[model samples]
Target: MSWFSPSRLVPSRLVPSLPPYSGPYPVGSCDVELSAADLPSPGSPPPNAPATIAFRLFYPAAGSGPSRPIRWLPSPQKAHFAAYARFLGAGSLLSTAVSLAPNVLYYTTIPARRNAPLLHPPGPAWPVLVFSHGLAGSRNAYSALLGELASHGIIVVAPEHRDGSAPMAFVRAPDGGASTSVSYQIHPHKPTAEVYAARDAQVRIRGWEIGVLYAALEKIGEGAEMRNLDPNLGVGGVEEDVLGSFVGRLDLRPGRVAWAGHSFGAATVVTVVKSAYYGGEEMGGPFIPARDAGIVRQITKSSVLALLDMWALPLTSPSAEQFFEKQLPAYEPGGAGGKAVLSVLSEAFWRWHGNLNDTKVVLAPRTAVSDDDEKVEQERRGPYIFYPEASAHLSQSDFGILFPWITGRVLKATEPERYLRLNVRAILQVLRENGTVVAGYSPLEGEEPLDGGGEGKKGGDWRILNPEGGVRGWLPVDMEVTSEDRRMSIGEETGGRNDEVRETEVLGDVKL
Candidate 1:
């Protein structure tokens, strides 16, 4: 069943392309890295002095010519492999074994073509999404999800957090000297005051890094030359001005670009969006206010927010009380922000009652008990929330697809590709309802690509987002998780994060 012998086959051969982008357009990818000095800042750089900002751009691209596929592990494959092994808690022996197969990783490539030109959509410009990776995640961590979104005509700018969250990174110097090799920074699994402080520090750095990325997008829209750190980058349309075509093709206008992330990355999305709209130098705590650049204006109440398995602990730090106290901008006084916001959790997180309660508390107003013991309920449009059946924390990410055997056989997480498709469908539908002009794929039952040409009801994937409409095991979640339910969940499963799971995995299926 493989190009090589059974024993000789590797992870790359098992899962060649990143599940295949189920959309109308071809996806193209490029690695762009910039330091503070390289950025064309009209004003001063962001605070926290983030050394470098690096990410992969996955966008709808011109499919005419031939292109080499970008490798999944990037350049210096051995280092990336070892770093991932360590991040996953593979012992020294397993880590060395993983590093020994650098060639295996080199052969593995996602479906996207390398450096292909951006496709010219019918609209003024393509909607953009600034995606943040979670702990043990790189730019390509959520390729299956982000790349799929790009295939449907969205430009996804996925940032690699150099705040010691990834396995390893070779950050380029501002002056183009030898690259700085940064490795993963580990914090205790326990949620102690010390852990909270460390996470807050990381969150601040992550938040500021996004501010710098926003500035870079602003420059790219103006046709500015951003010196990408990768020396071996493939030329797409021409050798020079690789980023030229995006001059007027990117929708970088205020309140246009969207925010998204997974796990800790999801928390980053919430914090940054909250900071952009509500927090400033005047209002302070650990929140990195968005006065640094255009972030304050770019991210508004109307901006679409898609959080997948948001890790609540980072937002729970006592230092961030000023931030956690405020409701999501979606609930902005008389604003239609709720429909655009969505949170898709894996079954694993839904079962972790305490974290589930915390996640709900942040996204929407919770049920309050009156002195007379009656539940107080109001007519509020909370962010659409749901969980796919038989899914794990890593299900929304590339980990499930890239390592199918581990996630499937060992972990019993069935339908990795299907669940991701479900997620893509729901998010795309939410985007559609939120005013983004990306093409809608047909219903999930057919698992079709983006609808070609004619606009019809069949082209709308809105049913997937509807609570009454049936999707593949995507059940409408009860937004109001009660105090009694949290107590019961503690008895059913461990109410803590494991290795790196936002909500630590509990083995058996407990009926929700």
Candidate 2:
């Protein structure tokens, strides 16, 4: 009878909930794919074909309508996940189970309407955010965060990279054939240079895709005919209708646009920004082809950039040098007004990478100022580093929040509400600095002062480091005083040790 109870081994209820959005407007979502024909392929000889880029758009909707059921994992994506699991050495049984029933472990419905009407009389077109997903991650993995942004009147366009970085992507043929899912293969034990080469190539293709999208948006703003600009775009797919709805509704104003990414995607953001400012070949090296200089200049001149826990900046090689030296210069304080940059890092990143020793050494010298410098000269010029104490690398995405039980094996469980509040606050600060929309709700209103003077340390577990004095000058926050050696002891209280008693006793002082 006990053996028949398999429910004890495998819990029936595993679906996780997404944190509710704290915004004013309803959210809507749509998907689109754009194709650019006869793009130059540097390494490949002749017969280079066109490039196709897929994107998912999340935006504010007109009214509160019946929400569409968003699939947690689409059919093709499930296959990709299975392949990815196997590639990462997950057991075959677990991989097959995950592939067969992804919906069983996660909530299937996303809180967004599909193809809902865009808010009409559009009170000023919404600001744009171009998001890049991490390697092997699809556009929908960050749906929770993207939906929240959209609800706050920010249009989020997430591009799905097709350069063998994504686990799988649907590639449509020009000859009207059915779309096919191409699963990217990962070569085992590749050399460091080869890995960097592959990543560089992928990032270049992503940059081009972004340039093409920006060009299309500019044309749309100029009221050019969409079909005439590219015949292959918005045709023969479900995305066609969605792309049609975006005409005349995008806000392409300079400085209002933002580019954000996580992990490898963050490297892409840095590369794109640097390439746009400097020449592509100069910033990305000889392996990378130059982009349209005009388009690159237009996009980079006024975009807010956010890098979410970027993995190893060195992965981009020469481009990484450009990012640290020329792109993110620390001597010029006024540069903030031009390209406002924000970097959000998790505690796990610091712990695993020895408190970011390499990064600190690279950035410290560039930001050091003279001790006798004037007040105005001492103003911070570099990116603000936001460190959330209880977070991990995956904290920026829904994966950590949704599957806490599984993720907790590697990292401590995060308080989703606290995490969201910290993220939203940091993002709002960057937006305000960039002169974008300011949040109606403020996080600093009723909070105690960060300095240790006010009512103790009750605010939160996060810190912001300014680059003016480099890593050594990290601002201090109120810290709670606690006993060091408070150990729990269990003892038998009753005669002859009949009953157990537990007590906590304080010993010597201990620093956390």
Per-residue error (Å), model 1, residue 383: 0.9
Q: Give each model a TM-score.
A: 0.86, 0.73
Report the C-alpha lDDT of model 2 over 1-512, residue by residue, as the tens digit: 23322244434355555765667778777665555552222222112223555677788777554444555454454565565565434443324434555655433446677766566424566677888887666677778778887776677888877765666677666456676665664632222566556555666566666666666556555555543211222212223234445566677764457888876677676666655655544454422434543345455444677766665433335545555455343224544432266666665554433224333322222444566765424343345565666665666777666656544544563664455555655565566556676334432421323544222332221223223322221322211112221111011112221111000000000112
Instruction: State each model's C-alpha RMSD to the native.
Output: 5.7, 12.2
Clash number by candidate, in order: 0, 1
Alpha carbon deviation, residue 375, candidate 1 (Å): 23
By TM-score, the best candidate is: 1
* Residue pairs with backbone overlap in model 1: none
Off by over 4 Å in 2: 1-14, 38-50, 75-78, 91-107, 120-123, 187-191, 220-245, 280-294, 300-302, 313-324, 329-334, 337-339, 358-380, 442-512
lDDT of candidates 1 onward, in order: 0.72, 0.52
Measured on C-alpha atoms, candidate 2 has an lDDT of 0.52
The residue-level lDDT of candidate 2 at 502 comes to: 7
